[model samples]
Target: MKHIPVLLDAVKDAIGDMRGLRIADCTFGAGGYSRAFLDAGAHVVAFDRDPHVANDANMFQNKYGNTFRFVPETFSHIGEIDGLFDVIVFDLGISSMQIDVGERGFSFRADAPLDMRMSGKGMTAAELIAKSSVDELATILRDYGDVKKANIIARAAKEKLPQTTFELRDLVFNPNDVAPVFQALRIAVNDEFGEIQRALAAVPNKLACGGRCICVTFHSLEDRIVKNTFRDWTTPPGDARLPETCPAPFKLLKTVTPDDGELENNPRARSAHMRGVIKTC
Candidate 1:
């Protein structure tokens, strides 16, 4: 299946006119947002940890010349980029390309090696299962996947670390539980939550004054992080000891979801939630 960016129109609307703006496309999955930003006359520096996207990045460099750059790094290290950007967009989570390929082991639908590394590095999902204690596995399932039967599933998964996706899927008899289980393992293996936290911490400093930060999150775990961080930035600094005159660094813009048309065209977009905020200080 072709990769479709979730909430593309909403993201463009949030950023407004991009002419002469420097934009950071943090996820750079299929170069979808980067392509759009370039088309709008924005100089885009796109980041993607996945090495497989090098070909696409090369194509962009060839076509856009000096207007575009591709960084082979994770968004968590976006702080390394020199200067601030007028706009920063993060489309978080695994890409469609990763999930569609069975060998990547992101989806339970395909029977392949149980590897779910986003950067194609680090410990594989099968290795995580093999090494983690039942308690650790249970915590991962509950926290990342929100799986209700986390304890039971962890115990089952621990009996034998499934070397393949089908083996893991078969361990969980309920059809409904398969997806969440796989998702939980994938997130743990990829350190996705930690990456997001680090990226969020680094974003405010990287955004220029009056700049916008937009995030497209696919799950509640990610959405909550973005929502709370944005809220904290916008909140007035006050306490029993602190002064009310302290200013906020950013102002909340708005949060939106895909419209009916977008949902119909891209069913994968259903879970997407977008949040936008502008730097004030």
Candidate 2:
């Protein structure tokens, strides 16, 4: 199945011209954006932390030849790529590819191991929950998921954890309703916010003059950091004292929401948002 790229029109508009452009796709889950850019005649280098994505690179190569390249590495280390580009696009957070894999345990609906690592490394979400105290789980759920049921969920999770995904779901998640607690554990496991902030701050320094970076964020915490980073980058040296609402270095290219058609076709795209910026330098 083709992984639907969220905010396609917005991405194309924000991406602008791509001919002969050197572009970096920071989150290259399904190579949707990378393929799109390459089709537009840009030289696209894409990154995905998941090793599994590399296997899919064969599809891009068979179709697009050298136009698309997938580097299996986290965006945090993507900065090591030399020089700037005409455009850098980041489609942040869990891809449909990962969630689709039943073995990865990203979905609460799926019965699998408790793992949620994007890189397939480190402690699985199951392991974390099993080891965490109620307070720890509560903090993770509240801060990561922005969940109001953190206390209740934590208390419930305390009863059983470090088990399979099914066990965790059975204990804390309401089978009738989706679990925000699961989302929280996934976010925590991935260190999503930290990865985002580091990438956001570093990209400006990596950009060439007038290079653009478009970010597609799915969650509020990631969205907030991107919003603030853009503001800070565009803000004047003395503007730090000003309130948060004031616009600063980069202009608000636009906040793109999914159209009804796209949302209807792919429910996962509902929470997706696109923000684009042009480098002031």
Candidate 3:
């Protein structure tokens, strides 16, 4: 499956046209934006926890050898990143490549291993669920998946906890309930929320003045965090007593959605919400 970038034109405009600027794509899934930025004349350093992508780096590097670099690390560790990034993009959550292929275990649509590691580390979803307490499973269903019948889901999940992809499908949820359960397990296995939180904390310090950070989230909960952070970072006018007014930590820029054409072609594009923050102070 081709990884057609969501809001490609808007992302280009939001990142702005800058010369010799350093841009970071935290989720360099299929080299969609990284390739585009490099083409637009910027130094691009992309990150992806999945080392598997590195195997294909030769393809991109061969084409754009001098300017492109792929860092095999999560975005949350931006503190360790060497230089400031002008436009730091966080396209959080899974990509279509993972979902389309079954071996990676991201989907319940086809059969594969129970593993759902975005970084290809940590316990597989099957192992985690099989060994976890019913309460633990219940919490995962409720908090991560937001399944209405979390307790029932937990009971079913626990029963088929150590199962492979199809095994768990049969044991935990019927065909209808499968998707939600799969989503919850995948999020927990990837620690998506925790990583985003850690990555967000480093943004204010990592970005240069007037630099922008664009984040596209696939899930409602993830979008909620990004929205709240953008709002809070506005740095409202407070403490009028201070000699000089404190500048806003960041400026909330636009929230963009893919056009209806794009959404109709790629339903995955439907749930996507893109927002940005620009450093103003």
- Compared with the true structure, all predictions reach lDDT values of 0.89, 0.80, 0.81
Question: Which candidate number maximizes lDDT?
Answer: 1
Q: Which order, best to worst by TM-score?
A: 1, 3, 2
lDDT of 1 by residue, 183-210 (tens): 8898899898899888888887888889
lDDT for model 3, on a 0 to 1 scale?
0.81
The lDDT of model 1 is: 0.89
Query: Could you give the C-alpha RMSD of every candidate to the true structure, in order shown?
Result: 2.4, 3.1, 3.1
lDDT rank, highest first? 1, 3, 2
lDDT of each residue in 180-272, candidate 3, tens digit only: 888998988888898998888778778888889899988898999888777767756573321131244677788998889988887888888
| Residue 51, candidate 2: alpha-carbon lDDT | 85
Best-fitting candidate, scored by TM-score: 1
lDDT of 2: 0.80
What is candidate 2's lDDT per residue for 1-281, written digit by digit as tens?
Answer: 46888887788888777798889989888878887888889988888888888777778878777777777888877678887777888888888878888789988768888898999888888778878899998999888877776788888877765466787777765554246777889889988888887777677666777788899988787789888777667667467643343223555687888989998998988888898888664
Error of 2 at 64 (Å): 4.1
